[model samples]
Target: MRFALNHIATPKLSLADFLGLARRLGMPAIEIRNDLPDVVGTMPAGAVRAAAVASGVDILSINALYPFNVWSGDVPARALALVDYAQACGARALVMCPLNDGTPVPHGDLVAALRELVPILRQYGITGLVEPLGFPVSSLRTKREAIEAIREAGASDVCKLVHDTFHHHL
Candidate 1:
């Protein structure tokens, strides 16, 4: 497997500096979290793309679009915008995180949400990495649930899972 460094590992660094460190560490890829300081969400697309090219580091994915298994009025549009940004930054995927804090949405609803989001992801040639948060309150607490949702949505072709070790072990 390819080693990928996440922006959370060096939260204080600028995007340029982070990519430089990934290159220095000989990591083939890096993941950028929009929540991280001085990363993609805070920087322009040109700068992010330039930093990746300059450091020769591939962008594996964007850290996340949260509560992606539910849809509100603006949620879909926001997801689309992030997908566009990911494509522009040359990232291969956009991470989709499920609802946390015990929202208790039904599995069918979750699957419906994925179905709604999948075509949007395909529009930009991006893959949706469905991440199951194992927190006590998370709606999706296991990979199996995420897989079920993906299958139900008929999004197997466009969606994959993000197995986070901390969440997995919890």
Candidate 2:
């Protein structure tokens, strides 16, 4: 299996430096994050894409489009923006994360959100890696829940579950 480095593992490094590190380490895949310092909103998509290309690393995915299970309150707009960025940056997928607040999102709502997101993802030619956050307060906290929602939404072709090892034991 090919191992990919998550940007969280080296938050202090600049994206260019991080890409260099990944290249030196022979890791072919890396996940970019909006949460990282001096990255995301601060940098241009072409810059990020160029750095990855220069280092010969594939951007496996963008770390997240958060609170994705909630389709309201600007989430749809954010999803489109992220997908646009991912496509422009040469990233293969966008990681879709669920609500992490204590509030619960209904199962029907979750499936509905995925259904709406699938068409957008397809239009962008990007995969959605549905990551169910494993936190006590997280609305969708397990892969099974994510899987069920994807199946219910008939979004199997557009996305798949992203099982985080840290969240698995949580």
Candidate 3:
């Protein structure tokens, strides 16, 4: 099986050091995180792009655009910004995680969000990797619901699922 490091595993490492670690470990790809301190946090997109090129490690995705299924207000703006960042950094996809905060977002609303994002992702030449949270409080607690939303949105070509083993066991 192939392996890619998620930056969350080493939140303390500088991007350079993290890339070095990936190279040292023979990993061709890595998932950078915005949630981690000083990782993708406030780094200029071009610098991140240059760092990826210098390190010779492919960025799998900007792991992630959070609460992506909630499509209105600031969410769309943030998603577009993340997509631009993903494209700029030569990442193949944007890891789109659903709202996990107990409160349920309607099924139709989720599908609508996917349909809305599908075109933006395609326009930026990036894929959207939907990662369902299986925690009891998660709004979309299973991959089945995410799959149904994708299907209903007719976005299979532009989107895919990230099967998080830890979440699967939840």
Candidate number achieving the greatest TM-score relative to the actual structure: 2
Q: Which pairs clash in model 2?
A: none
Better of 1 and 2 by lDDT: 2
**Per-model C-alpha RMSD:** 1.2, 1.1, 1.2
Per-residue lDDT of candidate 2, residues 56-106 (tens digit): 999989978888999999999999999999999999999999989899999
- Candidate 1 lowest-lDDT run of ten: 36-45
TM-scores, in order shown? 0.95, 0.96, 0.95
Q: Best lDDT goes to which candidate?
A: 2
CA shift at 53, candidate 3, in angstroms? 1.3
Model 1 compared with the native: what TM-score?
0.95
Give the alpha carbon lDDT tens digit for every residue of 19-55 in model 3.
9999999999999988975455679888988998999
lDDT of 2 at 8: 88
lDDT (CA) per prediction? 0.87, 0.91, 0.88
The deviation in Å at residue 142 for candidate 3 is 1.3
Q: CA lDDT of 154 in candidate 3?
A: 97
